[model samples]
Structures are given as structure tokens and as C-alpha cells.
Target: MIGSPEHFHQLEKSLARKLGIAAFQSGLQVLRNDRGWRENEISIDYIWMVTIDHSYSGEGGIFAIKYKESKFREKVNPGELVQGIFTNKDEISQIYTETGTTDLRGIFDFNLFEGSQGITLDGVSYTIRISGQNIDTFISLSNPNTDSWKKWEAEIWALGNRMALASGNKEMINLFQ
Candidate 1:
């Protein structure tokens, strides 16, 4: 699940109350959206576009483009690939770092992964990863039981709070104190 920073915290609080657990009391983790790839270069093989809902065309929605090398495809891929969130198609055309055709096309929804599972409350954990000025968040659920969990958990919390403060998230800043 990916959403705005506010939505991330709100969902955390809601889940905590419903599950009777504090798994996500810590602030969400921050991740860099642009994976340090040079502009206009397809350094990675895979590009993923993330959306919260089925709506393909909209402003102020989160989209992610990730890089992963493909084993089968080795040919040069063409066209420009944008690497950040944009408020509108105009913004994408104006501020796009990559160079190529500047044509705006209809956005389409695609599934990177799909599955179904039964619900279980046992050993559940919620972890949020925010990227790009709180424009996107990736929430992960897992059951972790490791000796170093305590140490890393504290570190992650501190880092998350710092990121939230830097992003000017007033709610997260208040929670930090």
C-alpha cells in the first residue's frame, strides 16, 4: 500500500487500534525515488508505475518508476522515461529531465504483482517506506523476530521522524516530540 504521508500515519493509527498492536507507532521510513540514475539514461531494465486506485489519469497522485535489469531483454529501449512525481502532464513535459519525445499520452494501469491470501493477525508487522517529498509510500507487512530488531527498529524510527520533520509534516513532527 502506497499513499501520502498523512495517509500513511492515518492508516497506521487505524490498524494499531483495530489490531491492538503498536507495530507501526514508529514513523514511516524514507526512501529516495530517483535511484541515482543519470538523466535520460535507461540504466535499469524494469520500470514500474504505481497508483493507489484504478484511475489512470489524474493530478496529485503518486507514481513510481523503479529500475531492475531483465534477464531476457537486451535490446535498446526507446522513448523518454520520467523519474519523478508530477502534478500534471504539463509539469511532466516542462520539468522532465530525460530527453525524448515530449508527447503526452493516456496513462494506463498495469499490475506488477497480484495474489490473494487469507487474513491473519498473528505476528503481523506494518512497515512504511516513503519516497520523494512524501509523494509516495510503500507499506510492507511481515513478521520479524530477530535479535537485532530492537536496535534497528529504534534507528529506523529516528530516521523516519527526521525525514518527516524535513518534509514539513506537522503531524509527524508533533508525534516526534
Candidate 2:
């Protein structure tokens, strides 16, 4: 899809709305410059963290999303797409790069092909992913009517519903609302 950043952002927001996620902002990048870390730009293809309402759990709850392009070094197919779920931002950040900051530390790791796609919190195992190899893949801001776009939307809705049910997070279930 060919579109401006703002248009892409709106598409993401629309997906969030479909999943009943109401409290979300555009994903942003923070880079260190001469003045320290500063906001850079919104992430186009990736949706960042989703905050669970406090009422859903005693402690704060959060989940993050990441889109990984297939890698040749690992023998991953170019057509394969991976979407990861993380318990915290730091975990996701590690896949991209270490932020060199101590503020985020709820750490865990996952490998798609190795079956390492889950985390244990309070002694409960939560499956943290839904992936496919070239399942009509891609969400383009400029091509909303493409087969890839429809497939992505369906998968997102299903995954969101499943996550919300498993986590007992009202916020996730009601995100779009």
C-alpha cells in the first residue's frame, strides 16, 4: 500500500478498534542524539505496546507486537512472516536493539522456529504468538483492498480475541470499544 505515515497510522488504529483496543498510540522510535534519547518517528509496519486497564489485573499489564521479516541466515523463507508477542517492551526492544537504558527490564526471549514463543508470569504459561508463512501477507497503507490486507486483518482480530480471553484482560477485550 502506498500512503502517508498518518494514513498508515489510521489503518493501525482501525485494526485496534476492530480488536476493541481503545487506548493505543502510534508506535514511535526513540533514538539517542546529542541531547540524549529523543522521539524519532512512528513505526509504519509495527504496532507497539497495548496497555491493559488497571481494573483487569492487580498489577499493570502490557503486551507488545513485533513483525519480523524472514532471515536467510536462519534458513527462513522470504515469504514467511513472523509476529511476536512479548510481555514487556524491553523484550521486544532486545530483538531490535538494546536500548542502553535500565528503565525497561521485564525480560524474556523467543525464537519462532525453535518453539520458544511463550513466557511464564506468576507461574502461568501464556502463548505469545500467531504466525504463518506467506498467508496473504502484508498490510500496505496504500493498498487496503489487497488480499494480504484482508488476511492480516482477520488474523489480528482472531489473535487479539484469543489473547484477551487467555489473559483475562478487560482492556484487551474492549480495546476497540
Best by lDDT: 1
> Worst ten-residue run, lDDT, model 1?
88-97
List the lowest-lDDT window of 10 residues for candidate 2. 90-99
Q: Which tens-of-lDDT digit does each residue in 36-136 have in candidate 1?
A: 43223233222222222112223212222333322223444342333322122212211112222322222222121432344433333433343332244
Local accuracy of candidate 2 as per-residue lDDT tens digits, 48-125:
432222222211123343423343333432322123222222122111111122211123222222322343232211
C-alpha RMSD between model 1 and the true structure: 17.7
> What are the Cα lDDT values of the candidates?
0.32, 0.31
Candidate 2 runs further than 4 Å off = 1-143
Assess candidate 2 and give its lDDT.
0.31
